[model samples]
Target: MTPSTENRPQMSVEDFEELERHASETVRLEFINGRVQAKPVTDGNHDQIIAWLQRLCMQHRPELWLYGDRGMKVERYRRGRARPDGVLAPFGFPAGHGDWSEAAGVLMAVEVTSHDSDTHQRDRVEKPDAHAAAGIPVYLLIDRDDRSVVVFNQPEDGRYRHEEKLPFGAPVKLPEPVSITLDTEPLKEFAD
Candidate 1:
């Protein structure tokens, strides 16, 4: 589900930032692949999924924290902005950050598939490429649509060189830098 950026309106980072700032609280905005995208307000099931992952991270890796809806600078040359569902990093990593933070020290960028028209292109394709290009070590996609988890790592040359997908009830290991094994059985309960 790769998105074609050819017809996307070219927007400067500054312009995107200004627009994002003025957007209503309910509307989250992102700049990916040279285009501005409005991120949909998550549903209850989506919130539950994020909460579940946050609890898991807290239990397995006390030193780390899963920051929800944390805006980040991503993609090649940090030209993109994304508000990932969760950004896993060391505790207090975002203490002094402004609206958007650099990708440094981020262990993983996570997205739980939203029930939306653009979920496929936004979560599955553009996000992985943006995070990989930013040199973020891992990109975790919890795909509600397919009831599976996709782990992407070993980023190189603006892409992830390794990818693995597992169904909702299986155990999934989020590789190095974020070495946590998830018992995904609980995820099935949240499947709408």
Candidate 2:
């Protein structure tokens, strides 16, 4: 079961950043809703899904880059720090930025659902809220659990004003700013 905010470890943003700096490479931590949570290590299928999207983005939007596991400062007033599975941004957007870069120019934040108890809360709920709160243009969720693709966009009042869910093998248009159509048929092979 996912822990409640009061039950999770609480820390200031500064403290969380310090802890993240000292964390080993294998451990990835996120500060969300004023609590510290460890992100699950991704599986091979997860990595493959990211790779597939990465290649697709590069081929279609050469001017943009899909960065894997890039740290981003999100949420209202940028209080939250998250490392999304894939961050789509203008080429070289993260240059000279610190560990957690502001989400200013981020076109999309992608998350592939991991097989874990907290997947529903973390990926489907909190992440979309955080990204939308940061005014990110799009939030793409490749949900393995449901074998579907969820596209979230049009941020307003700390939430996405629009959401579209399509089953695997369906065609998905990532919408503008992102403006890339995805042939999700390949995603079927990566489903767990």
Q: Candidate 2: deviation at residue 122, Å?
A: 0.5
TM-score per candidate, chains pooled: 0.95, 0.95
Residue lDDT tens for model 1, 1-192: 866779564789999999999999999999998899989999999999999999999999999999999999999999999999999999999988989999999999999998899999999999999999999999999999989999999999999999999999999999999999999999998878
Q: What lDDT tens digits, residue by residue, belong to model 2 across residues 125-172?
A: 999999999999999999999999999999998999999999999999
Stretches of candidate 1 off by over 4 Å are 1-9
Clashing pairs for model 1 are: none
Query: How many backbone clashes does every candidate have?
Result: 0, 0
Error of 2 at 109 (Å): 0.4
Residue 20, candidate 1: C-alpha displacement in angstroms: 0.1
**Top candidate (lDDT):** 1
Candidate 1 similarity to native, TM-score: 0.95
